[model samples]
Target: MLELLLIACLASPVGMVIEEPPKHEAAKVEHPKPEKKRPSVAVPEEPPTAKEKAAPVPKSTPKPKPAPPAIDTKRLAEAEARAKRLTSENAKLQEALARKELPTGGEIRNPAEALAELREGNRRFVEGHRIRSLLASQDPDLRQTLTKGQAPFAVIVTCSDSRLMDNYIFDQELGRLFTIREAGNCPDTQGVASVEYAVEHLGSKVVVVLGHTACGAIKAVAEANGKPLPGNLWSFQAAMSGLLETTHEDPNETAAEHLRHLERNNAVRQAQVVLDRSEIVRHLVSIGKVKVLPAVYDLATGQVLFLELPKPAKAGESAHH
Candidate 1:
């Protein structure tokens, strides 16, 4: 007990307390800093850099080119040659044909050839078929080519019947032939001039006297009953007067037979008249330059029947009807 009393007395004298000392007398301590709040850890963001956002660019396309021009020359060379051949042959064929002694049809070989072409074309037309090749042909250009000159293959002298379209009937392409259409197949100054041009300059090889069935001029002559044709129709009437006279029938003859006879004779008689008048045609014949043929055309069947192409007057024989 005495030892405990002695220690307590010494410690109390030093003034140390069990309770904490006052704020002023306590030793100071520095405060610890708070830990910073971090971002959510599953996906973190990097700061944006400059190079990742370069400006965008556009794409380019290419252009197209042009087209070329057209041409048509396949048949033209043959066509040119045929034209020349016909012109040459025509002058020879004419001298070998005449009125009564008519040359053999076969003598003018190309007459049959041309007729074959016409027949084939007409058949195609009737059947509603056309050569597609003809569509490809730029024949309007051919006209421009022909203005420099034309040498058509043959000549057609036909009745001026409105229904007769020789071009269509013959299926002749442009510049392939020379054509004359007249009432009663009459040849006037203008008509003769046309013939002269075809034979002399154009080198037309053959002249065909193409007469059609059921002609209006022939009908007019038949209706007259031996009476003179009307005054205004003199030129037309005179041309067929011989046809009316030669086929004149007794009043008792039926009208049908009268008209038929008139039609046929008109063709034959006109063929004779053509031979009589055109010396260019004659020279073309007598010299074997061209051939003249009498052809009767049928409206119903579109057929052409050649009745005669008399042989040339033998070189020494005086020839007449």
Candidate 2:
């Protein structure tokens, strides 16, 4: 019975030891995840047109320049011509007034005629009708004429006062009047030599010792009253002191009258002094070759008053005998 049971157990797999199946842990399966898709953008299919590609550019315009101002050429030319014509007419008028006959040689050749001419010029000046031509010693033609030789008709020894302009006072131009001036119209040796030159060399016939009112030199001498004057002024005072002493003062005369008397006396004395000191002038006067006159200029009236007029000699007396 046991053997039969073992055979049955072995055949029935119950009696043998059962073995456990192998336990292998299942391996985890790996798989790739699906990729995320981006959304698609739509693209335009058209190209750019020719008008859009070729754009026009704007042009700038330039500003115009301003016009120049007009000139009155015609009017300007007419004015210039008128001025020229007026100048010509004025020059002609001057020539007509100065026209005079000139005589041949000698000291003054004709003293009376020269005196008359001077008187006429003075009259013109007094009347305020001075001829322009007589004043134009600067004219080229007149200057040319004078350059030939100077023949002044008068020798004026007058005070060196600015108010006493020899040319304007006499209305005489260049080459017409020879003048000598000192502070008091007093002549020294040098002055005498100049006068001699004018008479002996220049043939001047008339010598006028001219004085004026309010002579400063005369006043100074009077005020000094024989006291010594300062510097070179002493010479002038000394020369004038003798005249002051010789001048007779009137008791009833006003101060102005006294001053006027002194002025007149001073002029007369100066004229005598010229005669006394200059042998040449004395000889000329004695021979009737020249004349010396004493005159006073009035500052207020622009008039010259003759204190004494020298008598004109006979026609033949003018020539040196």
Name the best candidate (by TM-score).
2
Pairs that collide, model 2: none
lDDT at position 14, candidate 1: 14
Error of 1 at 177 (Å): 2.0
Task: Give the Cα lDDT of each candidate.
Answer: 0.57, 0.65
- The per-residue C-alpha lDDT of model 2 at residue 236 equals 81
Question: What is candidate 1's lDDT per residue for 1-321, written digit by digit as tens?
Answer: 222222222222112212342343332222333333444445347323332233242444533333332323444443434334433433333343323222212232454465555566566444443221132222444345445555665778888888787666665556666889887676666776787787778666677777878877778766775677777666666666556656657688777766766766676666666667777777777676766776777787776766674454664231223
RMSD for all candidates, in order, please. 42.3, 50.2
Q: Over the full model, what C-alpha lDDT does candidate 2 score relative to the true structure?
A: 0.65
| Best model per lDDT | 2
**lDDT tens digits by residue: candidate 2, 1-321:** 222222222221111311321122111112333332332335234333443345463455644544543546664454444334434443443443355322212223656766665666666566654442243323555565455567788888999999898767777656778899999898888887888998899888888889999888888888788888898889987677577676788889987788888888888777777776788988888788888878888888777777663333652222111
> Which regions of candidate 1 fall more than 4 Å away from where they truly are?
1-137, 248-254, 309-321
